[model samples]
Target: MKILALESSAVSASVALTEDEKLVAQSFQNCGLTHSRTLLPMAENLLANCGVSLADVDAIAVAHGPGSFTGVRIGVATVKGLALGADKPCLGVSTLEAMAWGARALGGDLCCVMDARAGQVYNALFTVEDGRVRRLCDDRAIKLTELAEEIGEAPYFLVGDGADLCYNTIKENCTGLRLAPAELRFATGFGVAAAALPLFREGKACSPQELDAFYLRRPQAERERMARLAQTK
Candidate 1:
């Protein structure tokens, strides 16, 4: 089975191709360009460089959410368009899960955190065993203090854009925490492909019509609008 995956749930945008469990090709960019301008083009370039066409891919996968709200939408929209055009199945992998999967080679527990700002993070916990990741917690928007308290002093590799933020907050309380290397810390198309494989196997892949983003919280604009309505009421 061939899978083409896109990851744009953060500042970085990446595209990857995987055949079964093996990654065939990948392109990642964090050059400060907007994902709307880089994502589809990067995927096109990757496929061309690999001498493969969209028609050759069996499924399309993307990091679905819990990162930048705009970035998540761009990724999901792009995947939906690709899947619709190719008439292939689409898989939505969690951005947090992909971060943990990206660091699976480290072979330890993972604390995946994405900077959700305002002293909070999009967080999840996972354990890697025998090269596979098992989730220990559901995705959530949580305060750094609460996260630090929950993780305790257990040794874990922190992975994601918010790795440093989490490390600094929990370091005093959690002595065994380690920050993942720069390469493994952020979301990647390869990670998305790897994380989506199990979901595909479990028949979780869906049509483009079913593709959607998984924002853990409301966007600031929506919150502001609601606040104004509450004030008027």
Candidate 2:
């Protein structure tokens, strides 16, 4: 099976193509360019370079949420259009899950954290054993102190944009924490493709109309608006 995946849930944006479990091609950029200006073009170039067409892909996978709200929307919308145009199924992979999967080779407990600001992070925990990832916690926005307390002393390798923040905050209390190397620290298109494979095999891929972003919390702008309403009331 062939899968084309997009990852733009953070500052970095990447496109990747995979056949079965092997990567065929990938393009990544992190020069502060907006995903709107880079993601689709990157995908086009990657497919062209690989001598493949979007029509050849069985499914389109995308990092659905828990990162930059705009970035998540861009990825999901792009895949929605591609899936509709090519008449293929779409798999919405979780951003935190993809990050965890990126560190699967490390083989131990994984704590995925993405900067959500306001002294909190979008976080999740997973256990990777024998190249397989199992979720130990659901994705949610949480305070660093709460995260540190919940994790306790279970030696975990952290991976994500917020890894440094998590590591620094809990390092004193949790000496078993380790930061993932730069390459595996953030969401990647290849990781998205890998995470989508199991979903595709389980027949969980859906039509373009059913695809949607999985934002664990409301966007900041929405939160601010609601706060104003509460103040007035």
Clashes of each: 0, 0
Q: What is the lDDT of residue 3 in candidate 2?
A: 98
Clashing pairs in 1: none
How well does candidate 2 score on lDDT at residue 134?
Answer: 95
Which window of 10 residues has the lowest lDDT sum in candidate 1?
161-170
Alpha-carbon runs more than 4 Å astray in model 1: none
- The model with the greatest lDDT is 1
lDDT (Cα) of model 1: 0.93
Per-residue lDDT tens digits of candidate 1, residues 88-199? 9999999999988888998889999999989999999999999999999999999999988888889999999999988988799989899988999989999999999999
Task: Give the alpha-carbon lDDT of every model.
Answer: 0.93, 0.92
